[model samples]
Target chain A: MTWETVIGLETHVELATRTKIFCSCTTEFGSPPNTHCCPVCTGMPGALPVLNRRVLEFAVKAGLALNCSITRHSGFDRKNYFYPDLPKAYQISQLYLPIARNGRVDVRTQAGDKTIRIHELHMEEDAGKLAHDPATGLTRVDCNRCGVPLIEIVTQPDFRTAEEVTAYLEALKETLQYLGVSDCKMQEGSLRCDVNLSVRPAGSGELGTRTEMKNLGSFRAVARAIKYEAARQIQLIEGGGRVVQETRRWDEDRNASLPMRVKENAQDYRYFPEPDIPPIRLSEEYLDALRAAQPELAQAKRARYQREYGLPEYDCRMITSHRALARFFEALVELGVPPKQGANWIMGEVLGALSQRAMEPGDMKLTPPTLARLIALVGEGRLNRNTAVKVFEAVFDRDGDVDAYVRAHGLEQVNDDALVREACAEVLAVNPRSAADYRSGKEKAFGFLVGQVMRELKGRANPQRVNAILKELLMQ
Target chain B: MNITPELVERIADLSRLELGQEEVLETAAQLEQIAACMDILNRLDTRGIQPMSHVFPVENVLREDTVLPSQDRAELLACAPASDGETFLVPRAVE
Candidate 1:
């Protein structure tokens, strides 16, 4: 019998604000430890947190983009916990009343489109980073992240597979990034996910014991951990052993999860409404303005690209997967390259380079104009598609002028059809046997002739023109 | 809402605390009382009430991609309980 996996996620997105949530300290990452900390974040005596207005605006924008009903009244609560990372013994978080709820995100899985229900998205302060010293046997806590604003988007256990979980995360990240709530950079720790997964026998009504995987820093890791954990749980249960409820850490090196600690129940938090901070009353006008500021999210953008750009579903999905890449596509189109071709190149060469370097489109140094010029070269037939790829690589290397790169490399396309026919005729003269084969209905000879023409033109020949010239020469 | 001894131990475990027995019993009682008081929120019809996440609304607040100069090593090490010239020192770590 097949076992079904149940997956939920608690995604912590560090807001891309310049300052801390409750204090004016810089929300910068990778600084010297404790440098960004102040009296309020460090929980010194008599230091009161004055909430940053940007934090609230970002949260409302997030709520609106997530399709959540923005709360008119919400307040912070004190989640009582004693950990070294938390400078304040009790973290100021929302529990009894969260910011937004009942939102759903549509993710594309193999089973087709599935909507995952968002339980709630709550605002809270981040704890410090525990930088463990390997040489010295101590875990040092860096309080720089303390009091940094975070929106914890908790999802219901609506996903049934690792692929679905990944799709959901990709959709969520795109929405958050588009809304400008967070950088959504998993590598930079701006956006991170914790997956809760459990497995049960097929057709079982009762939920199985779940193991929570914490702080998966990448979408790939989340998918792998869920898949690994689901199989492990199923194997344990099928072997007549009970599945244990625990918190596991994914060791990417080992490609397996190890037990960190047992899972904690909700009552363990002892959550209480914070007395220091009062209830926040959001005005209708304020929410309306925030709604207006919310840009088209990834799904909506993908649909629009499919409809407006007349791109295939694959191209639309690839282009809209990254907001920066999608924006670049539109910018290139504005610069006169056709939308479909722009989408294709961005999906093909641009995404390929980024993936090879394990980088995001935002990390690209090549500007939209430079990419537009490259796309235009291909469109005008001044650079063959293959040569355009070389030009793209050159542009990436030097961040140089595209026109200069084309001129320096002598990489103009062989669009002179008469010249291409001459090269095809030479192939016909040299390879008389292949020419005879073509006359005898050997279709493979056509491919050989096209290759010979491309090789002769140093890949500068337009492939379609070469194919047409080869067909004409062979027929003669 | 009544925090029993069992509840206190469980919460201490969740909080990763090494509390004394007397403290556990006392804290559990306090937690129970607090939980009961907070339960008052349940009675109020919040069926359609939107939960607030933050108090203010600000957008597109970004910092420039600039790196400013920082303090010397000595200044930062002053905050550390123990430190070497370029790194913070601590007990010997295993693996």
Candidate 2:
């Protein structure tokens, strides 16, 4: 019998705040253990937690972008648990009044367009890092990552397949990156996802027992776990067994789901309103300012690029896929570079350079102004496309002086009328066979003569000018 | 309100606290007294009065996003019960 799977994702996105949620500790990653910790983050006695303003602003911005209704009055609650990584016995999170609710995003997959409904997005602090010693089996705790702000985006079980789940995740990642809310790097532990999956007989209206799968480090793992768990549940039910509602872990090594523990009920946490931090009340004016300040998202930018700049659909999609690339393209246009020409350079030269050097668009040191100058140099015939590409490669890494590099290399195309005319005259005199063949109307011979003229000028003369001068001299 | 031994044991278990027999009896009495006092406060129901969630009237007390130097690693790690000069070494943990 065919079975259908239902899935919900709880995505925890670490905000790109400069400081921790409750304290002034730096949120920079890869710091030594206990270095980026303070009394508030380490859960010292009598220490009070103060909410970060940027965290609230980012949450509101994310909510608006996701088509969610923002909660004007939101407060924090304590999720009481006894985990070793949790410095405090309870985690400060929002439950009763989350920052946003009832949001939705349109995700596209091979199946079709599906709307994923967002249940709620709440703000909270991250737990500390823990590692177990291989020799001693002792768990080591590092408070450096404690108090890093995160927004847990809980979605409704609107997904029917793993494809939809991954598509939604990719779309969500793009939107979050575009919003500048979070970097959404799965490898960096900045973005973590847990999948809740259940399987039932096809055409069944009743829901089946679901299991929560954790430790999905990547999208591939999420998809794999969903399929494995769904099949596992379906197989159990078909064999006269039952699906247990529990917390399961996605073991990437074993490629299977293992029961972690009995499901931790909400009542187990004993959630109560946090007495330290006050309820955050947002004014309409505050939200208005935030909405007004929202940058153009990928979809809007793609449309604008097509309408305003008349760029090709493929080019618009490629350039606006990343926010930094879009910003750079806009900067280039603002520097008086033609849109299509800039797009070509970015798609061809810039992208080639990035891949060859293993660099991200943002990591490239080549400034827009410098690239525009290179384009201008090519447009003016001072530098041919060939030589300008070399110049780009040279300066793309160090952002070196473009003009100085061009001058030092003597890469300036031969633009002198006299020099090109003389070079054409010599080439014509030397290649009389080709010149005679050209006079006999052999089109390829003409190209041969032009190559000769270019070689005569040491491969620096403009080929168009060389061809023009050669034709003029050949006519004689 | 009746506070049973089972109730005290469950609460202590949730909090990861170990209680002896006499200590459990003593803690049950204290918790019962505290819960009874809260019951007294909960009984006062006035019409048209909003439930108070926080004692402070202020809202949106937040700090700006700025990076400041964290507490010294040596100092902060010193607060731990056992540290090897880098991280806190807890007993072998499960998961």
Candidate 3:
């Protein structure tokens, strides 16, 4: 029997707020352990929680960008659980009424563009991180990330393949970055994903037992987990065995999923409205203001880039996929550089540098004005394309002065007519056989002579000028 | 709704409470009484009454984004059952 994979994603994105969701503790990452914690965040008794207004604003901004409907009346609920990371024994989340619902993200798949329906978006507090040491068999808890603001975006099961899931995540991350809501950095855990995958007969309307894979650290791991889990379920069904519903952890090293534990029944979270914090009442004016403040998202930016800059659809999508890259490209164009040239440099060189270093676009420190000047040097024949690329790489790493680098390196193209003529004449005198071959209608020998002149000029000769000068001297 | 012993056991398991068999039966009876009271309350004619999540009339209670210094870390760790001078030590967590 043929089986089809069904998937949904629940992504947790930490907000870029200055303070924690319900306390004044700083939400910075990678501080000394427990340095950013306080009585409120650490779950000390008699310490009350006061909501951060910035958290609400960010949640609404994200909702608006994701095409979600913001709820007028939403409140927090206490999801009761016991874990070492959650000191309070309960996490403040939303159950009955979340901040936003009924949103959709449009992702491009192999079939076509499909809209993945968002189930809900809720504001919640983040739990601390538990780092386990295998040698000591101990787990260390870091509470610096505790009580940080997070918005969990849950989507309906709309993915049929790993590609769709990845596309949806890419689109979601781009939208979040464009909105300035979150960094969406998967490596730093600013964004985390949990995938719910199930398999069913191809023509069956019934969905099979779905298992959740928790806290996939990277996109590659997400894709691999989905493929392995889908195959595992399909094989189980074919073998006349049943797939047990449970939580699984993706082992990146083993490249397989291991079941964590099997639950005979679902664990009830015992959710109740949080009594400490008041209900969130959003006004119409507040939502409208947030919508007005919303910047152009990735989709609109892609359309505008195609229409205005006349860039190819692929180039537009690639450049606009990351907000930082798009901003760099625009800054170059605003500096009077040609749009196509800016797009080419960003798509080719800038992206190549990022991938080579295993870095993101945000890690790039190269300024657009500096890059614009470098491009102009190439256009003005002061620096050839090869030398321009080298200058670009140097500036990209050090953020140094582009003009100073070119001058110090003596990379200026040899455009002097007399100099090029002397170099060409010297090459002809040494290579008499080549000159005779050119005279005897061996066209390939002429190209070899031009190469000799270029080598003699140290690759600084204006190639087109060198070609013209070599033809004139050879004909004579 | 009838509160069964099996339901009570499941809830005790979720709450991380190791309830004895006698205690499970006793808790089920008590829960049944509570549920009967809730059923009586549910029978009232309150169609027009707005459901309130809190008794207080306040909404949007918030504070400025400023951080205050926390209490002494050594004192805070003293309250835990186990500590490593910097963090609360617990049985190793398995996922």
DockQ of each: 0.15, 0.67, 0.60
| C-alpha lDDT of all candidate models, in order | 0.80, 0.89, 0.89
Q: Is candidate 1 or candidate 3 better by lDDT?
A: 3
Q: Mind sharing the TM-score for model 3?
A: 0.93
For model 3, how does the per-residue alpha-carbon lDDT over A1-476 read when each residue is reduced to its tens digit? 77899998999999998899999889988777777877888898988999998899999999888889999988999998888898898899999889999999988877898999999999999999887757567777777888999999999998999999999989999899998989998989999999999999998898889999985889999999999999999998899999988899898999999888655543668899999999888999988888889998878988999999899999998999789999999899999999999999998999999899888888788888999999999888898887788888888876878888888888899999999999999999999999999999999999899999989988888999999999999889
Ranked by DockQ, the better of candidates 1 and 3 is: 3
The stretch of ten residues in a row with the least summed lDDT in candidate 2 chain A is A259-268
**What lDDT tens digits, residue by residue, belong to model 1 across residues A360-438?**
7887888888988888788787888788888888787457799988888778888899999899989889999988998
Q: Please give, for residues B2-93, the per-residue lDDT of candidate 1 as tens digits.
A: 78888788867776778899998889878978888889976888887765444556322333422333334466556567765444444432
Pairwise TM-score winner, candidates 1 and 2: 2
- Candidate 1 residue pairs in backbone clash: A57-B57, A57-B58, A71-B50, A74-B52, A99-B51, A137-B91, A137-B92, A137-B93
Q: Model 1 clash tally?
A: 8
Cand 3, B chain, TM? 0.88
Ordered by TM-score, highest first, the candidates read 3, 2, 1
What are the per-residue Cα lDDT tens digits for candidate 2 across B1-95?
88988889888888888999999999889989998998998898768895457987898899988888777888877888988788888897655
- TM-score leader: 3
Measured on C-alpha atoms, candidate 3 has an lDDT of: 0.89
Where does candidate 1 stray beyond 4 Å? Answer: A1-3, A132-136, A199-201, A215-217, A231-244, A252-257, A261-267, A408-476, B1-95
